[model samples]
Target: MIPAQFDYVAPGTVADAVAALIDGGEDAKVLAGGQSLIPVLRLRLSYPSLLVDLRKIDELRGVREDGAELVIGAMTRHADVISDPLVRQHAALLAEAAATVADPAVRHRGTFGGSLAHADPAGDLPAVAVALGAQLVAEGPGGRRSIAAADFFQDYLQTALAPDEVLVEVRLPKLQGRWGVAYEKFSRTAQAWAIVGVAAAVRRDNGAIAEARIGLTNMGSTPVRAGAVEAALAGASAEAGTIAEAAAHAADGTHAPSDLSGGSDYREHLARVLTRRAVTTAAGL
Candidate 1:
C-alpha cells in the first residue's frame, strides 16, 4: 500500500532537526533509516503530516570514545556497528546482536536508534542496549537530556522521547575485567525475528562469576534484565547446574506475548532455556 502524502525536510544539523520536529509538532515524524517507519507509513499505521529526514545530520553519525564511555551516534547503521573493530572488541554483545538483525540487507539500512526508538520487543538492538546499561542522548529545542536504558522504554511500542527531541546518540560504558559476552537468538529461519533472544555478559574472577548482565528479547513488552539470574550468579559457580537454577526466574516480571510463532508458556520456557545457554556461552563453558 502507498503511504499518505507528507512533506519532507532533510535537516542538516541536530538543531535544525529539533526545530523541524517542534514546528511540525505532533503531526511530524523523524525519519532515520526508514526500514521500520517506511513500513508503518505504507501500512497507514502512521500518517504524519511531515517527515523530518535525519540522514544529513553529520553530528548524528559515527562512533567515538569519551573516557570510559563509547558514544554511538543514533544514525549509525547496524551493518557499520557489526563490523566496527572497536565495537567488536569493547562491546562485542552489541556487534554480535547487530549481525543477526534481519540479515545484511536490513542491517545495512537500519539505524541503531531507529530500532531502539521503535521499541519492538523482538528487536535485537534494544535488548543489547538494556544489557549494556546504555544511555540515550536526546536533544530538543529545550536542550539535551540523557536517559538511561531502564527509563527509556516505557511500554510496548512506547518510549520516553518527547515530541520535540531527537535521539542523538547512545552511550555505553566500556566493558571491564575479563568479560565474556554472547548473543544467542532463536528464529524459525534466516531473517526471521527472534522467537527468543538472549544477550549475556559475564565477568569471571578465578573461574567464578564476578558479575553478570543478561537481557531477554521477545520475552516481554520491553527488553528486561534478568535480575534474579544476576543475583543468583553472584558468588555462585558458573557451571551448568547453577546457571540453570538462576535462569529459572528468567520469565519472572515479564509480560511476554503469545503469537503464531509461539505461545505464552512456550515463550516462558524459551526465556529460561535461552538465558541459560547465552550465559553459558559467554562464560565459554
Candidate 2:
C-alpha cells in the first residue's frame, strides 16, 4: 500500500531537528532508520504531516564511553551494535539480542534509538535494555532529559517521548563484576517476532547467585522486568531446579497477548520455559 504524501526534512543538527519537530507539531514523526515508521506508513496506520529525518544528524550515530557507561548514539544500526567490540565486551546481552532482530538486511538499517522509541514490546532490544537498566536520552524544544529504561516504555507502540522530543542516545551502565548474560527467544521462524523471549543477566559471587535480572518480551503491552522472578533468584542456589522454581513466576505479572502466534496460556508457558533456559545459561549452570 502506498503511504499518504508527507513532507520530509533532513535536519543537519539536533537543534534543527528539534525545531522542525516543534514546527510540525502533533502531526510530525521522527524518522531514524525508518524500520518501524516506514511499515506503519505503508499500512496507512499512521499519517504524519511531516517526516523529520535524523540521518544527517552526525552526532547521534556512534558508540562511545562516558565515565562508567557506554553512550550509544540513537542512530547506531543493529549491525554496528552486533559488531562493536565495546558492546560485545561490556553489554553482551544487547549484542546477542540484536543479532536476532530480523536479518542482516534489516539490521544494517534499523537504529537502536529508533527501536527503543518505536517501543515495540516484541522488539529484542527493549527487553535487553530493561534487563540491563539502561537509560534513554531525549532532546526536545524544551531541553534534554534522561529516562530510565523501565520508565521509557509505556505500552504497545507507545513511549514517554513527547511529540516534540527525539531520542538522541542510550546509556548502558557497564555490567560490573563477572556477570553472565543470555537471551532466549522462541519463534516460529528464524527471523520471526518472538512468541516469547527472555533476557537474563546473572552475577555470581563465590558459589551462589548474588544478583539476577530478567526481562520478558511479548508477555505484556511493554517489555517488562520479571520482578518476582528476579527477587526470587537472589541468593538462590544456581542449580537448575532452583532456577526453574524462580522462572515459574515469569508470567505472574504479565498480560500476554493472545494472537495467531499462540494463545495467552501458551505464551505464559513459553515464558516460564524460556526464562529457565535463559537464567540457567546466564548463571552458567
Candidate 3:
C-alpha cells in the first residue's frame, strides 16, 4: 500500500529538525529509523503533512561517557547499541535486551530512541530502560530537559514527548560491583513482539541480594516496574526459592492485556515464570 503524500525534510541538526516540526504543526511526524512508523504510514494509519527526518543529525548517533553515566544518542542503531563497549560495560541489560530485538537486519536499522519513542509496551527496550532507571533527554523550542524513563512512557503507543520536541539522548547510570543482569522474553517467533518479557538487574552483596530492579513488558499500557517483586527481593537470599517466591508478585500491580497472542491470565503467568528465570539468572543462583 502506498502512503499518503507528505513533504519530507532531512535536517542535519536537531535545532533544524525542531524548527521543521514546529513549522509543520500537528501534522508533522519525525522519522528516525522508520522501523515502526513506515509501516503505519504505508497502511494509511497515519497521514502526516510532513516528515522531519533526523538521519543526518550526526550528533545523535553514538555512545559516550559522562561522569558516572553513559550517554546514548537517540539515533544510535540497535546493532551499535548492542556492540558499543560503553553500553556493554555500563548497562549490560540494555545490550542483552537489544540482542533480542527482531533479527540482525532489523537491529541494524532500528534506532534505540525510535523504539522507546514509539512507546509500544511490547518493545524490548522500554522494559530495560525502566529497569535501569534511565533518563530520556528531549529538546524543543523551549529548551532541553530530562524525563525519567518511568515517566517517559504514558500509554500504549504514547509517550511524554511533546509534539515539537525531539529525543536527543538517553542517560544510564553505570552499574558497578557485583551486578548481574538478564532479559527474558516469551514470543511466538524470533521476530515477533514479546507476549511477556522481564528485565532483571541484581546487585549481590556477600551471600544476599542487596538490590533488584525488575521491569515488565506488555504487562500494562506502559512498561511497568515490578515494584512488588523488587521489594520482595530486597536483601532476600540470592537463591532460587527466594527469587521464585518474589516472582510470584510479578503481576501484583499490573493490568495485563488479552489479545490474539494470549489471554491476560496467560501473560500474567508468563510474567511470573519469566521473572523467576530472569531474577534467578541475574542473582547468579
Off-target runs (Cα >4 Å) in candidate 1 are none
In order, candidate lDDTs are 0.91, 0.94, 0.96
Q: What is the TM-score of each candidate against the true structure?
A: 0.98, 0.98, 0.99
Clashing pairs in 1: none
lDDT of 2 by residue, 1-285 (tens): 999999999999999999999999999999999988898999999999999999999999999999899999999999999999999989999998999999899999999999999988888999999999999999988889999999999999999999999999999999889899999999999989999999999999987899998999999999999999999999988898999899999999799999999999999999999999999999998
Off by over 4 Å in 2: none
Off by over 4 Å in 3: none
The candidate that wins on TM-score is 3
Extract clashing residue pairs from model 3.
none
Over the stretch 52-133, how does candidate 1's per-residue lDDT look in tens digits?
A: 9999988888888998999999999999988887788789999989989997888889999999999999998898999999
Better of 1 and 3 by TM-score: 3
Indicate the residue-level lDDT of 117 in model 3.
98
Candidate 3 differs from the real structure by a C-alpha RMSD in angstroms, to one decimal, of: 0.6
Candidate 1 differs from the real structure by a C-alpha RMSD in angstroms, to one decimal, of 0.9
lDDT comparison, 2 vs 3, better candidate: 3
> Clash pairs of candidate 2?
none
* Model 3: lDDT of residue 140: 99
